[model samples]
Target: MSVDVRWLGHSTVTVDVRTPGGSLRVVTDPVLRPGLAHLRRRPATPDPAAWAGCDLALVSHLHHDHLDLPSLRRMRPTVLVTPPGSSDWVRWRLRRPATHVVEVAVGQTRELPTPCGPVQVTALPAHHAGHRTGSGFSRAPRGAEAVEHLLRVPGAFPGRDLDDLLLWAIGDTGEFAGSDAVLAAAGRAPDVALVPVGGWGHTLGPHHLDPRQAAELVARVRPGVSVPVHWGTLHPVALGATMGDRFVEPGRRFVREASRLGVAGAVQLPVGGSLSV
Candidate 1:
């Protein structure tokens, strides 16, 4: 089987899985807007209409950038998958009429029916927080050891009602367990893995993977093809061309590291670029 993968920007990726019957398109984290809060999307905003035929949309977390309400409003995916306990928020946030939303947790798998065939989607563990605050600054925390510790504790934000509604963690044995479950549930390595290599910040915090770490993940997942994403799309407006390199560097670094790690079929594509694998 071969799939055409497109890097739309940030955590958004569109995959066209071709089969003997027909084609099925799956989109992950559809954030098609130009600007959000202090972060301004870089050039080449993808056409929103590109998402019209998406059969399945997967949202990794509740962060505004990944689950932008405005962006989701424009999309018309047949089914939307979000982390467990996120259906209510997703429904409330969306401006348009309701779309079919499915809540999935780590290790849970869903089979999406398409004209081509049945495509299995397993919700794998991600080492990132799922908390979302109205203020963007609250979501982008800095520091190293301290932040890492806080992120490891799922739903660390005490007394915050929203945090209580979602599960988030990293640097924990449970994350590994969930990953193992996903692999076992699939019964084989996935055809393509969309891994987040970096974020829109000067330095990566806990629960997030840099280039080297992302490559390590690819080695573990052992997918037929691994594509590096979550980079080269958005940046802080205040930094303004000073740290412009951060946007593109992570993806490039991940490609080099994936090659060094001997991951089979590691591929990197520019934003708005597509590759058939």
Candidate 2:
């Protein structure tokens, strides 16, 4: 099996998992918005169509960046996998029903039969939160519902939602309830593991994973190769720093510590570059 992992800055990654016949590509949290809040836009823009041929799309959680409906709709993958409570959001944003989105709660594993073969995906526990809130809202009770309905209008959802929904992940700061569970439910190891190592602030959160925490997870999950993400994409709201500076270091940190910790197979790929593993 060969896996091509591309780092489109931050947590967005395009994993092209290959078998003997063809390839099964999996995209993780792709963002294409610019000048969001404090963080500046990525210097380069990655074409979503590059992933147009992907077999499956993985929305880790409901942060705008991860579950951006606009970017999601543009890809048009055969299958969509996300955490619980995400179906409504994805379906609503994509102007589709919940049935179109595959709901995978933490610790749930599903086998997607792709042209290459069976692509196994396990929904692991992430320390994150998802909410749909825009600046404008009236006092009416159903105002939120009305906005949701508009998003759900057929063909109204575009690839732009990926940026509108600012997905915020609280890093691994506190005791995790499902950290061990994610490792356990995975059963056997995966060919490629995409882990987050940056956050919205300088100080990491209990739910989010810093470089060190990501390294530890890498050791635990023991994937063939680990790609660190969730950094360098968006600027920290609190710190007022660029996404590139904040996230670039942690990936290097993960490499050094993982190597020092004797955890092998730690590699970093350039944004828009490809890796065969």
Candidate 3:
């Protein structure tokens, strides 16, 4: 069996796995539209229609860029998987039926049947904080009230911290007992792991991975092939020149760090580029 991994800019990746039974395609964190708020998509905007046949769509978190409603509508995946406590928001925003949405928490697994076989998806824990955008209060509070609120509240005002899932896709598998079985089998490493190494900013935020961190993940996951996504796609519109530099530099940094960490088979793919393994 072989799988074709395509980087469609940002965290959007389409993995086409071929098995004796048939073929299945899985996409992650698709943001197809251009010029989202203060950010503008760099050159080579991905075609929304190219993702038409996606059997499964995996959303890592609820950030606007990662879980864009407009982009999700364009893909219209058969099944959408998100972290726990996010199904309600997705359903409400997408206006899709509740049945189409599936929420998987950390250490949980969801199996999807395809013509080739059953593709087992295991949700692993990620380091980043997965908070929803605009989950805070509408108006800014002043002085002592703000201090008291900050002291009392655990998280942001509205949205709670989400389960930042590092999705592991296992292809050509027959049946699994449960999440535990899947984890044990995953000890052998996945054929392809879609790891997010960077984001749309110059500096990565909390719960996100920089080049060094992503390299460490490569060593830990030990997949047959590692493709670094979520970089060089989107940047702040106001930061001229810096945006262009960020778009191409982070991938190179990840590659260098992976090599330094003695991780083999780390492939830094360009937007719309693909590699088969």
Candidate 4:
């Protein structure tokens, strides 16, 4: 079964997972609107409305951009999955009765039942802390660690030995030692890897992975296909003039790094584009 992946912007993507059991559509960290605070989406979203709605949403962390309440509301995924310690915050912050919210801690795997079938979701450790603190905003729950989600498809199908396709969303994270071991716990390599190669601001902290680091990780993971994300998207409104090639450079650099590393199937997908693997 082939997987269909669509890049909305930043770390947000819609993956249509099809397996023998059934088909499920999942969105990641949706920021569907035109702008997030002062950071405006560049190149413009072809159709923000197209990213709305999903069977499930995989919120990797509590960062404002990654776990936007308004965006989630717009998308209206039947279920919202976030890291541990943030579920309560999300429910309260959303200002609604979000009873379907679930928390998945690092190294924990849970099977979520969808209309089609159950899908296995695993929380993998990331090097960043998932705390949301800013002016005029409630601080996110303490001890909320950032995470990467491994979405394994077609879970727990009887007699068929399902869970064939694995889509790994390597959310915002810095390169850490022995991260491969954490990824190996998925029991199999990812079929399609979504790697973050850039950021919204001018400089990236140690908590984020740059273009080169993303390429290096992909080479190690050796996924069937790799697509660059978190770049060529949003940027601070004030720094828009100063951000010359910053939005597009990371993607080009990632492609170059992947080629240099001899990593095949590295794709540079534009915003509002889809990749099938």
Candidate 5:
């Protein structure tokens, strides 16, 4: 079996998990607009049809860049998974109750049914905080908990080191002390990992992973394929072309750093690009 992973800029990813039984498409953090706040997407916004038929969508957190309501409403996957404490804002703002939204907590597993087979989703711990100004009554869900995700199919890929076709989407986060145990929840390395390597502004700072840290994560997770995301797609408009390495270098830098760390499978996908593994 093989899976196609597409990096749709920032933390947004479309994973097409294919198996003999069937195919399941999972999209993460759908921020599909051209611009938001001080940031502007450098890549073309994906057509809604590109993701409209996804089996499941994962929301890492409620920051505007990750959980754009307009983008979600446009794609409208069969089911949506998010960290706990996100329902209220979606219910109030999204206003699309017809969309099946499941609130999953860390360590909890939920089975998502598709036409082909059942896909298991497990929320993992992340080390990011959602800041709020005035209760999030205006925009974004400030109280939502951010999380990483481990997606698996019971028997998709055959003749691999792992029986199940496991993939991990490591959303926006920085290194934390107990992260080894957190990553150990899945018991083993995933077949594929979509990791954030940079932020939209000057630096990723301590709350997010820069290229070097992202490479370190690859050293730890040791996934079969480490696909870099969250870089080379968005930039701060004020700086114009002056952002230089911060805006345009994380993906390649992460690959290089990972290689230096002996992680041979680290790779990069241009925004809107997909790779099968």
Candidate 6:
């Protein structure tokens, strides 16, 4: 089977995993350059026109970078997979009428018909929580007299469809069973695994996996090939001031850790780079 994977910079990737009949195109976190905070100053920019034509787009979480609305709207994929509450916000932004958005919960799966074959999307557990900041009353006023709407749980969403396709862990801050979803999805071994190797800045957040952690994950999943993402593209607000010197360490750590693990599966590609499997 021939599989094709492209690094769209950061956590975004266009994966063409070969199925028995044809090819399944999967995209992870498609981010455009302009709206993003750090990438704007680059001498050159990624040509959005060249981005992969994806069959499905996966919004790993609710973060601005991961679930970038502009980029998602641009891709306009037929199917969008994301954590609960994501569809509603995305739909509101799109203003293209109610769209076919699938909300997934951890440990569930959904299968969609595709040209190559049926592509299955699975929701893996994430330890990190999603939040939306708000202030002032909107058109609807909060009830002072009566009980108000209960605050929705951070991770709640519609039912999940954890089916045939491999696992896609949205994002996590800590080491938990939910964090282990990648291992479960791989199920002993996977043809290829796309893992988060960096966070928003030089410092690794408690919620995301840095390159070293990603290397640890690669060892556990034991995939035939491991591709690192989520780094080198965006710098944190604090680090952005001095990003010139901070971006390369995570990737280098990933490589070093992989070497130490004696795991020959690690493969690194340049930004907007691609590799055939």
lDDT of 2 by residue, 1-277 (tens): 4445677766667766544555566666656555443555544667765576756666655555555666666667677776565565466557644224776654455556666655555554444444434413311111111000000011111343321111112212223554545334434454456666766556676656777877876676566676766666565455544334664687788888788778887886666666765
What stretches of model 6 exceed 4 Å from their correct place?
Answer: 18-20, 37-44, 97-99, 132-173, 236-241
lDDT string, candidate 4, 1-277, tens digits: 6578888889988888666666678888888777877788777764755565478899988887788788887667888898888888788777656437898988889999886678788898888878875723576677787899898775422344544667888888998986665357767667788899989888999988898999999888888788898888888877788888887789889989999999998898888889887
Q: Write the per-residue lDDT of candidate 5 for residues 1-277, one digit (tens) a residue.
A: 7777887788888888777787888899898899876778877988665576878888887777877778888777778887778766675667667678887788898887875688788888888875433454675556678888888876667776566877888778888875544357678778888889988887567879888998998898788899888777777776757777665678889999999999979988877788888
What TM-score does prediction 5 earn? 0.92
TM-score of 1: 0.80
| For model 2, the run of ten residues with the poorest summed lDDT | 145-154
Q: lDDT per prediction?
A: 0.63, 0.55, 0.62, 0.81, 0.79, 0.59
| Candidate 3 global CA lDDT score | 0.62
Query: Candidate 3 on 156-210: residue-level lDDT in tens?
Result: 1123242111235321111112312323535555445565677787666655667
| Clashes by residue pair, model 4 | none
Poorly placed runs, candidate 3 (over 4 Å): 136-185
Model 5 scores worst on lDDT over the 10 consecutive residues at: 131-140
What TM-score, over all chains together, does every model reach?
A: 0.80, 0.75, 0.79, 0.92, 0.92, 0.78
lDDT of 1 at 197: 79
lDDT of 2 at 138: 15
Scanning candidate 6 in windows of ten residues, the lowest lDDT window is 144-153
| Residue 269 Cα positional deviation in candidate 5, in Å, after optimal superposition | 1.2
The list of candidate 5 runs beyond 4 A from truth reads 131-135, 139-142, 159-161
Candidate 1: tens digits of C-alpha lDDT, residues 1-277 = 4456788888787766655566667777788888886788886788765566887777766777777777777787777776666666666666445477876555565555655655555555555566665535433322111111000111223344432111111221112334433345555555566767787878777667788877876677676667777778888886757766786688788889988888877788888888875
